[model samples]
Target: MGSSRWIRPEIYPLFAATGVAVGICIAQLVRNITGNPEVRVTKENRAAGILENFDEGRKYRENPVRKFVRGRAPEIMPSINDFFSKPDL
Candidate 1:
């Protein structure tokens, strides 16, 4: 019991790693079954050429907040930038 207790702590990291690996494998398996299949350029697809007005090719519009920030420069401190940007007279 004493030796087993000592061994358990050392083996805990291995157990955790194995559990994580197993979980990832299970997740991938489930995703493969439920998710869309990978797109491949087959001979038939090549002959078909580019799809016109593809359903998935619709233009993506940003949300209001995202659009507002899109053109603006990222600043951690706008006040600091404003102060530094002014010409020293």
Candidate 2:
């Protein structure tokens, strides 16, 4: 009687957590190099941008929940019909 499981059940969670940790580490490293918000906010040059980001986040967070949502997303919107139709512009 032999078991065919390549990965032991006891180690699965450990491996999964390790993988997640590694991925997060890699993501943070990339974000750091790419000037992510957290890293850039630490710099004096980014004061305005940091404030803008916070203001935007706050505005979004403070917005009241909508009873109903409308429209396709902007990119997907403005259909072929829109080409024939002129705006106020």
Q: Top lDDT: which candidate number?
A: 1
In model 2, state the lDDT of residue 38: 41
lDDT of 1 by residue, 1-89 (tens): 66886777779899999999999999867755444233324677557655564333322223356777987779878889989998888
Task: Tell me, by TM-score, which candidate is best.
Answer: 1
Residues 36-68, model 2: lDDT tens digits:
444553456556453547764554444333323
> What is candidate 2's local distance difference test score?
0.61
Each candidate's TM vs. the true structure? 0.36, 0.33
What is the alpha-carbon lDDT of model 1 when measured against the actual structure?
Answer: 0.65
Candidate 1 Cα errors over 4 Å, as ranges: 1-7, 38-89
- Can you list the residue pairs that collide in candidate 1? none
Clashes within 3 Å, all models in order? 0, 0
